[model samples]
Target: MKDNLVDNNAYTYYHTVWQNGDVAPGTHYLDVTANDKFEGIVKVYVTRRYDADNDHVKAFAIAGANDGSEFEKVADVELPNAVKAGKAEAEFTIAEGKSYSKLRFTVTSTTLERGYWHMAEFQLRPMTLNADCKNATYPEAFAAITKALEEANKAVGSVSVEDIAALQNAYDEYKKAINPETGIDAIGVETLRNNAVYDLQGRRVQNIGKGVYIVDGKKIVR
Candidate 1:
């Protein structure tokens, strides 16, 4: 497929045998949700079951298709051959002035072909550039309101654990500090307690072992 500014990569594996299967023996479909797209030079790696003599299909190539019917070759050369059994790493470049959405691998006859080849271990990652981050466009006025809230919070210090239960009051005080005339901010005071100490859902928990209980999403060491 064509490469663009957005770096995306993915993996595909034909674990099932062709010909004997319902689909044809040539092309198969792959899900890209697990792997992302590619932006520039992508490392193509695969592990296959079959090999052709010494010249066995050491490497493979990529073809892009928008509708899955007609296909066009993207890379000129086949990926480097994998001498080992499981993985082969071949670098393929996304050509300039072109972008691709979908790609597939075409398997030519290799030397050792008893059954069809079984392939796996695919990867595509960005090498040239990072993706862009756009600013949130909804709130032109909310920017100033947020800035005032930050300044007011800086004037206040951290709340202690004993007073942690009173965290809801902090939001009210900040709202009042910003708008002295109207106390409406205090009307809808909401408190956010990080229950992750006992729960494990909202935050990313790490360093957990077996037989642990996850509460709310956090791992509780048993």
Candidate 2:
């Protein structure tokens, strides 16, 4: 993917880069795992091959995500004064401590003369994280949580009631163990059982109505 950008090859005829024949809005996704190492900044390169009749991309919105499933908008670029012909490039700095492995670019309201959207190159350059600040503990915990959430999400339709309750209980316990400021575990299971309510999946709740819930990690139907 990195070579495609620096090679100076115009992707006008074929689908070398991401190009669409239709003028409608389209979204393009790119995985930047090879370039991103919890980086702090990302540089984007967009090369336009030809421009006639004022045909060009209007507005583009960029979004990033750690896990490909969910994405958050990172940058919004508007070309009010359309470019005639040339390469358009921009550099975006990520949040102080945040990083993303995947990026999505959506182009909206493009003007096409030949009924095609042309993009010669789309490249990403991510800044490397410092070696001294690298920590594996947080990432391991995050991976475990992500895996649990993925399993919960996959069990939406096929899981049994008991299975759901067990999964929820596990999640609640995990949350309690990780939350340093909450100190939920210090409150004692007996007190939590008396005060808190559990949802059908065994998650603890407050002020819940008539339904299945979990108290002290035990499932109860109310």
Candidate 3:
């Protein structure tokens, strides 16, 4: 039995690097929670290809963790045919259920005369028992939005009359359940735009000429 887990039931990663993106290498972090029954082999499967000549480098690796820290390299493999035929990959294991942060891959080759290697995609998957539906906390998901609103309020205090009207209209529509899916909370955008007065002809009434005019965290011109 293991204490860590990898859930790969949702999405798959893919890539194809051509002349424009001749080479690519990076890392990705995923947040997941453990199930009541936490024990399985964390599996990472990578599908990649090199598109070059005399390119000598092709490989992929996987690492695992228990609490997103203290990572350990568990799986590593070299693609023998990739250097010659430009195709190779491997799968490896790690403990599952905790949280693995750094799962990465590196490819080094010289194909297409770019002096750098070209790759398709290096992907990773974690094996799990099943029943994993962990999601983000409300505060965690709204952190960026809250931060933006705070910055906007610092620049411009209070919502304007026009914004208040818009908010009311939106709220009325929401209350009536008209197009229930359409209305986003007008609390943010309305507050900012309301402060700025505009003429009936749709021109900015404020004499905001030349210099920068920051409205609701966005810059505007005269």
Best by lDDT: 2
Best by TM-score: 2
Per-residue lDDT for 1-222 in model 2, tens only? Answer: 444443444433113243445444654333445443445666665665443443455566767788636878777765443244355666676677766777666665455522223454565645343554222334444445445555654454466776566656665655555563444444435545566764432345545433344566464443
Runs in model 3 deviating more than 4 A are 1-51, 54-61, 65-68, 83-87, 96-99, 106-118, 132-222
lDDT of 1: 0.40
* Residue-by-residue lDDT tens digits, candidate 3, 1-222: 011111111122233343554444332223234333223455333222323333333454444555536656655655445432222444454544344544433443223223233333333333343443211222332333334433433334355555434434443443344232322323224534666633211234344322224355244332
The C-alpha lDDT values of all candidates are 0.40, 0.51, 0.36
Ranking by lDDT: 2, 1, 3
| Candidate 1, superposed: residue stretches over 4 Å from native | 1-14, 19-37, 48-57, 67-70, 80-85, 113-116, 131-222
Q: Could you tell me the TM-score of candidate 1?
A: 0.39
Candidate 1 lDDT, 1-222, residue by residue in tens: 222101111122335445543433234333332133444666655543233222224434566655445666776435455543334556777776544566655544344422233553444544344344111231332344344433433333443443322333443344444453342322222211333322111222332222222344222332
User: TM-score of the candidate numbered 2?
Assistant: 0.42
| Poorest stretch of ten by lDDT in candidate 2 | 11-20
